[model samples]
Target: MRQYLILLLLFTLVQSAVTDSPRRPNSNPPKGFVTTKGSKFVLDGKPFYFVGTNSYWVPLLTTKEDVESTFKQMKNAGVKVLRTWGFNAINGSELAAARNSDLTYYQVWNSTEWVLNDGPQGLQRLDNVIAMAGKYNIKIILTFTNNWVGYGGSELYVNWIGGAGSTHDVFYTHPKIIASYQRYVKTIVNRYKTSPNIFAWELMNEARCLGDLPGGPSCIPGSGTLYHWYNQQANFVRSLDPYHLITTGGEGHFYWKKPVGFWYNGQFISDYNFNGQAGEDFDRDLTLENIDFGTYHIYPQYWYPQLDTPGSNFTLKAWGIDWIKLHAKAAKRVGKPVILEEFGVTGLENKTDIYPAWVDSALSTGHGIMPWQFGALGLTENGGNRVIKYADALINGASPNDGHAFYENQTTVWNVFTNAAKVQDAKSK
Candidate 1:
């Protein structure tokens, strides 16, 4: 759904005991991390790039040892930021507090959710996580909900109970929904308004525009739902927190008309416009008045040449640099900061790794990127979409370096970021 920040700052006191050198992001965030209009942010004063990963879900209500490892890994890899989700279990405290009318994302088998209520713990919990993240010098592109709350898939609906009654997607028509969202935002912005580590406010991860559910056309707002959620979420975030950057972590918003929110109906450029080969890739003009940054989620599902069997040959794997370039260029052309939020060559057998040089080329533009994921804990016969073993190797219990994709020369993505940051720094002067 979105990328996660796999980083942890567990070695702070120990490091301080040995040496007083500060960390990259935490040591005192550079002025560049701040958001200012006209000259909002400059990588070394010039356009900068943000490279990071995503944690599919965060169990704010409960703690997990593995979660910390992911963030630690990203930081070790020099990943600057993390695209993370604000958890809200379909059946969590927030929804229980909502009691009945609200929707919480408790449908999935083994997914964690983080939602808030009218109490101090929820708000305090977020602040605590944010503070911990600050220790690693990691900024977060935080999303309010998950992808299980909408449609029949994984989305973060506030009151979703995931029953027959709650199967249908919840709409903004509910006042409680809007109020809950606002309350969460107010809590976050009011508390961290001055914090430099918070990167941006991602409205929702992969708000879809579906003509119908994967099965049929009975989905509410199926075709028309995309625009509804996009506009509403934009207005909602702006009304609550307008200071930082705002974006929807959709699959590919460069040309895809709608972003995450509805999960209604949509098609990749080629499939929808041109018969699966190539299409009229015009900018959808999605830069809503409230949005400051441009964002997209690219997982090779649509772009991969042999999508179904991309894993058949890692060499042929699709989540490569060329795809990032095309998508970034499209976003840049649209006049907004480009972000590759959800993407990774995450497959069981076909794990096609993105090499570093390819990363160097893609990040040459110095744009921000959040690699699709941080860890995939356990795969229950997944459709080869996620690789649990890789995530397992990427996770750990004590040490913090577990969540990073370690094979740099092999994977090459880690190098992509370092190389880009170097170039961006050189240009800053």
Candidate 2:
């Protein structure tokens, strides 16, 4: 009897240890879901060097036909993956004042609490997008929220919980705010956790210490705060959905211990992007055990005007290429895949001149690339080709002529992506 009691105690201790052990990578991801395999994305036991595009308004459109048309155009262009907005937060007053009664929204803040919209004008819109994507054989990376104010983002949450004078960064640490965000996350993740078409779940779109509104007095300017928030949120997502991949939808800013300076035209800026001012440290963020891959964006025309000039020795093209190489190197160091998730240049001629070289760089470095947007061509009243736009991107009938969108009519620019997709597909096989 004494010997048996000792043996049972030992067995109980061993089981407890196993229960407390850290989670291992999902060795057997479900079929048709994307997973990482040592510095590359693998889908169904094959390398997935996907060339995709962003279409944030796909879920916000009022008509299912428009959604199908968008997916059809993307499929024809050889796009295998797409990154889009999976969040739409609004207050009741805003919804009431909307011009269209059929406006789509996912969550609504009703003065004191959040009411999730799972009806036809809410998450059902997203359901349509996922259904169409699966039908078209494309995967989706769904971003949970935005850092900007264009679509009720972090600021909206701040306003909701912290009230009138709250800072944007409070969305990261405040317990109430975090709980609310996670409630929405849990609802969405649980609803579609079994979907094979979900490529990944992004924590936020371009998460930063500051947003369109001010940071106020309580914001921290380093990587620690956001890092903590990322670990918390990412682990939560992983806990709920172990099969799908996860990523931080960041702009890939660095807060290096030994920061590197680069020459931008004639100026040597030491600490613009590399500094921790934005509270983003790409290297540090990627190191979190739950984070499966890394992502970075390139918008030299907007972020670094000095490099955007043509005829310069170090033009935007050169800088953008180097950026791709840098992130690829980091991905290798961390033993994970890194994607040049977004890149774009203004003007059709500039895009024609610059994007091919950037695409080639991403391919050479074994990194995936998605441009800022992909636009579809629609017929005007006179039967002329006009670009279909939605949400805040609507200007006349065209998408935000932010000059970054690659519309179907711009064949030269469109071909750059289609050809890259073909090359990527060939490499994957």
Q: Mark the 10 consecutive residues where model 1 has the least summed lDDT.
A: 273-282
Each candidate's clash count: 52, 0
Clashes of 2: 0
Report every candidate's CA lDDT: 0.47, 0.81
Cand. 1 Cα-lDDT = 0.47
Candidate with top TM-score is: 2
TM-score of 2: 0.88
Report lDDT (Cα) of residue 4, candidate 1: 27
Q: Which stretches of candidate 1 lie over 4 Å from their true place?
A: 1-33, 36-40, 43-46, 56-73, 90-123, 149-180, 210-224, 253-282, 301-322, 347-353, 375-421, 424-429
Which regions of candidate 2 fall more than 4 Å away from where they truly are? 1-25, 99-101, 216-223, 259-269, 306-314, 379-400
For 290-341, candidate 2 gives per-residue lDDT tens digits of 7899999988778866654666666888888888888988889999998888
